[model samples]
Target: MAEKTTSTVPKGQKSQFAVPYYEISYDKFFQFGVSVDCVVFGYHENRLKILLIKRGAAPFMGMWALPGDLVYPNENIDVAAQRILRDLTGIDNLFMEQTKVYGQVDRHPAGRVITTGYYSLIDIAKHDPHASAWADGVYWMDLNEVPKLAFDHSDILKDALQILQQRVRHQPVGFELLPEKFALADLQALYEAILNESYDKANFRKRILSMNLLISLKENQKDVPHRPARLYKFDKQRYDELIAKGFSFEL
Candidate 1:
């Protein structure tokens, strides 16, 4: 005969049945936690920068790190990402794409926690970051000048950046970081900052103009040290139509 186990219901709770119960203990299952980290890339001063927050809590307190936090038990990963980013950085509603999962057994000092890295690009001048929650301060650091980061965030940033570079090369996602009206020089500089490479001025300008993805605004830079360059805006409507017809954007 199979042995029966006594029900371990709480004192205030009543058992549904009067017979002995057979319960499968869940204690033998592995317990772990999941978290989300955001790598927000922005273009500023003709350089690529990412948002970093100074930690105010333990397990790397006082160190600059990506805005991240533990995921709640009942929360979705994407929702957790948005919530965590808003709670720590005061920015919201930006589209973020998942990049990688860092699951080193000892990555987190607190416990066995796995973190998913998400990345997004934005116009730095548009969204102002305000640190809150466990973040003591928030700032943007140049990609090359980023100091050692907390936890395994450096690896996460690097992987996300690689994906960003690849995506930028194939898609027009870089426009998300540029002003609506911009000079070709501004566009080239943004690309260079992201790809970390320089292109011949004439060649780059000619290639971009030939694509017909830019609409001449008949406007020029108002105040500048150099000759005023004609401004153009990304022809997003045309781009969408072309993409529907199987046209791919290639840089």
Candidate 2:
């Protein structure tokens, strides 16, 4: 049996990978730290708000930044993001989807550090997000009022807000920010707030009501100076039934 020779390159083609390959000591190579930051969005008072904390320690100390910290060596990226959100907002089991990775050479003051950004949407009235002692202040600032943030957080916030705007228009996640019982006007207000635009009352109601996903409640709004509006609740069961029957949702 003669020895066989093999090449990944095709017989008729030249190998473009002519460059040599070598390995160096892993510890001697340039290394970077990884962290997770969260853009926690809350919808309240008919305005979209994002949670921000005043940095307590050095390296942009006293400046506002997205809630975050360095990822531990043993932690999964999702768990790290959850930890960041949990520590900042005291909410557990959040679906903190990774939005983007930021790795500019000079983004962080702490040498080479890259951060994974995540965003969360929640109802503000239901949960009062608080800041730890480390943070001098914590507030749900309206998106329009977002100030210059620490590090590249301002950019992260910009991208996350854009994602929220797009996702809400096409998904049922917007219902998560609303109470179990709501009015047609309430839903429209939410959409307008997120999309930063208004919808014609007649068209918006006709289209949404056509879906038949709302359960009209007998109760009406109270304690209002204006005429009370009829309340309705999202029928998740109906939505699921429609989905199973190959009906897709769209705005």
lDDT of 1 by residue, 1-251 (tens): 44444456666655555434546345513478899999999888788999999999999999999999999999999999999999999999989999999988799998889999999988899898899998999999999999999999999999999998887776664456778899999989988999898998898888888878899998999899999999999898866655455443344
Over 4 Å off in model 2, which ranges? 1-25, 28-30, 240-251
> Number of clashes in every candidate structure?
0, 0
Across 1-251, the per-residue lDDT of candidate 2 in tens digits comes to 43443335556655445533333444533377999999988889788898899898879998999998889988998999887777765766877767889988789887888899999888888776677646766788999998999999999999998887776655654457778888788889888888888888888888888988788899999888899999999889876665456443344
Query: RMSD in angstroms, all models?
Result: 9.1, 6.5
Which candidate's TM-score is highest?
Answer: 1
For model 2 the local lDDT of residue 13 reads 56
What does the lDDT read for residue 113 in candidate 1?
A: 95
Prediction 2 global C-alpha lDDT: 0.80
